[model samples]
Target: MAKEHSLDLIAIGRSCADLYGQQTGGRLEDMLSFAKYVGGSPTNTAVGAARLGLRTGLLTRVGEDHFGRFIGEQLAREGVSTQGVIADPQRLTALAFLGIRDPDTFPLVFYRENCADMALCVEDVDPAFIRSAGAVLISGTHLSQPQVFEASLQACRIAREAGARVIFDVDYRPVLWGLAGRDRGDDRFVAHEGVTARLQEALPLCDLIVGTEEEIHILGGTTDTLAALRAIRARTDACLVCKRGAAGCSVFAAAIPARLDDGLTGRGFAVEVFNVLGAGDAFMAGFLRGWLRGEPLEVCSDWANACGAIVVSRHGCAPAMPTWVELQAFLRGGDRPFRLREDAALEQLHWATTRSGRYDELMVLAVDHRSQFEELCRQTGADPARLPAFKALALRAVDRVAGGDPRFGVLLDGRYGMRALEAAADHPYWIGRPIELPGSCPLAFEGSADVATELASWPYNHVVKCLVLCHPDDADELRERQERQLLRLHDAARKTRHELLLEIIASRNGQIDDHTVSRAMQRLYDLGLRPDWWKLEPSDSAAAWRNIERTIAANDPHCRGVVLLGLSAPEEELAASFRAAAQVPIVKGFAVGRTIFADAAEQWLAGRIDDAGAIDDLAARFAALVEAWRAARTHGAPADREIA
Candidate 1:
């Protein structure tokens, strides 16, 4: 193998929030809601390359505001290095409000009058950072202005000096360059001599150049496609690639040919186009995946076309780009005119592969018991209204225990834990909100039964947790109903891109044995319900734990590990359970709710303890359990450790 570089690519340009209208086939004004995603050509390409398993980085500036921070965090989660991502205190992040009116017509408005990303200047380019990458990608959109243009040139200059490849994406948008109205951000091309002149200044420095037919026209300073290719070919010897929409793309490694199609080319996929906004970026990403690996040009075209085909069929750009696993699966093709968004298997792979927060050991606090909280209030003659604040207090205990580690998750409910959920929106901790109506036997969603819509209203940090008391020995009718509800919830989680943590209690119906839980898991996996996490009762022996692990590994190796449910067991009883699961790697940690918080909550409710006392009690108990779990993981649970 060749000596490796510190990074495969570093994309330089804008990174902002793209608010795509939730309701497609409508006007932007009439659209009620939008799904925000990390966008901007350079960042999109960076994210795409990262998803394709490339070691990528981004050099851009975003405001210190919420959206700006969101872009930074999102890039990091996508596995793109944010070392060059600067937090601009002076300017706010950019936003693009867009709507798909029809298959052909779309409306876009850029909110970048003085956005932070546009402030990228020559000073932001780090020569060492540029040299660390095998290649640097410069988006043409950054060439529209003086500051960003200089930054792009500085990056390109440094890349060439270091013998690193430079990739130029002729990502032309007339509105960005003032050739069109500010609102006409969707306008792909405007014939301007100055824009072409600006692009030409950086052409000699690039190793590979990519653009659409219209984009190439803008760069070549001509209306005719062939003439434009020839004109641009004269300025530099960089390999040219012209994106030809549904015709795939054409490559020119030697010289401009009489017919663009006469060059080495690959045909586009026969998939229906949903939106053309980010296909070019996806194409760039796919191309780089192979190019950086020294793969042949034909293979690169194959990847680029497949990536473009997949993204154009989806809603947003960055999120729609397929990971390496997803791309390879799509390349194995099932049928023509692919409906990628509706391909459940592919979409599932996308979710499984691209998601973050893979904790080495997850220690969750399961405080999402709605009826249990209400029952505690009822027994103590306390107002149910007070439960919300108590739930917040319980979350505070979790916060106190976690100290901002993402491994410490909280299974909360919007019914009473809304304050906690909303407050922890930006918290590093993993927050799971329950969807199952409390103690519902057959399992029903908490609100409106419209699980998808309910999930959509939830914050991105919230994972959808559903507890079902399903037994392997259930009657036919009951089993079918339970499976149906689970399937519904499963699909809803997929559509909303929410991670699912399924808690199954098999003893709910019949006599329990070690294999019963494994059987229930097998049934769910057979039904194609692959949850991100599993909350299961602790196994009494290592053999039972082995069965559980085999069942999970056989069905879905991507299954995020499991956590043991407390089931209101006493702290002493739970210690033994934790000891049994100590050798089982699948059992990440415990989500013991009542064991940790129930006593304190009851004390607070019955007025036996004040708020400070109750909070201290809860925090102490939670902290003890965490320590016990860690000890068990490290050196096995001590048999003589006294209960708290």
Candidate 2:
């Protein structure tokens, strides 16, 4: 297929933003908070297929607003081609507000009054884009409108001309067809001959037709399942897949069977359902993932059912779609948990695979010191208010050293370095904010007891850094307390969509065994706390680094590599440490503070150096450290620039 086509599938239809109510088992009217996600059937399918390693694209129109740009950016991040996605300047992006009141009741409100997705016109359909895909997927919602109906039909014609398969997902929505009230957006079907006739026009152009029983009833003009299948059979020779909810699904590629299960069938999971909103889209995506590869019908059905089951057990659709890794794990046939979302390993893979970023080499500056700054101010008798400007100056030094580089990051705190964080966030620099209170033995957040609430005001780009001085040999009570705190912070990070970077040291008072630090990491993973990045102190030997990396790889292979933390060591010692670290591939880079800026900051605070001198000194020191790191990673001679 790759030799003949550039893409596996092209999904054409509505695209919109979904704002889901956060209050589960609560009425939509009483919901307090919400989370935004990119939604719509074809958009979800494209994202689901892309996450399963399929080359897919979307053909739709979004409003020329923040949500529109957001949809485009998110699709691109999900590995779906957005070249065919156009923006309609005259309309606002569509939005859906949904709530889960019970297992069966999902109250939804769709804000799509002349929305952007419905603005897709015939002129927006590109023949080449449709032809390059192995198949084209057109949802039934787009056929309800005049302009988009013509555009979807044109795409089908192009696909037919190019010998590429055309797939029709009979995504029947009664409210969308004007058969229900505006507030009844969740209505599945209505006995409307007009809507069925409109859908029949597009069915004959399809090579594969997928729909639920009610949807087939809408398409085939009958309430009886077999009669509806026969009616659809008479219109086209395309394969028919009838979803049977929790009973699984049946696939009939030839004649209609005497009974539904008499045809080829795939078994479904016996797990409980949460929200049945996006399961059908997930089912179609899973079907195409196998169907495009020319797999057997039974295999495709199994994948389809499993995908649907997975999504039905989760909250949001696009974000809840299972990746290839998670699918494989679930299909292994074992005594499984009651809910797929409760599987730690599966959830970890989902979080890791869906994350969007690249930090091949993260060279971050460590300036998120709180207690140290206070001590410096106390010693120098300088006003505490000067610290914000000092931190801003520190950022300027980093800017002069490395401007707008994604690899260069700084760790700052909101208590003192909020101004610097505001400035650094505007550029492309990777930024991290520390939340752990300084000198807290068992660990505590710097501000409110509710860490998650405190992290709400942070920007999305700012990573959450927590310094834990945990020793494996510590008393069990103390260790348990520390682990509990770590779990809370980890949950907060996930809730806020911020990456967590754990600085795991044996103890700040002195050096414990290097092995103890590695053991601490393993224990954290056992608690189901998988941090994205690990910040560790430099090891004395290469073997220690190997063991540490092995522990991380075994627990969560998707873990971002480790960063070497500078404990304000001497310049010569740090240079030697960097050279030795070159022997380990897991160390991405270093996050050093005192080694690069301690002496310079001290001199500036003592009035021994002006601001310009301090900036010049910090920049040169940082640049030299960066060069030394490059040399170590590249097998070049160790750099000789002095910092002390």
By TM-score, who's the top model here?
Answer: 1
| TM-score, candidate number 2 | 0.95
Q: Which stretches of candidate 1 lie over 4 Å from their true place?
A: 1-4, 335-337, 639-642
- Summarize candidate 2's per-residue lDDT along 104-219 as a digit string, tens digits: 89988888899988989889998888888988999898899999999999999999888889999999988887889988888888999899899999878999999999999999
- TM-scores, in order shown? 0.95, 0.95
lDDT of 1 by residue, 324-401 (tens): 998998988875346667777787788888887687788887788889998899899999898888888887888888
Please estimate how well model 1 matches the true structure, expressed as its whole-model Cα lDDT: 0.87
Error of 2 at 184 (Å): 1.1
lDDT, each prediction: 0.87, 0.87
Give candidate 2's error at residue 252 in angstroms: 1.2
- For model 1 the local lDDT of residue 552 reads 90
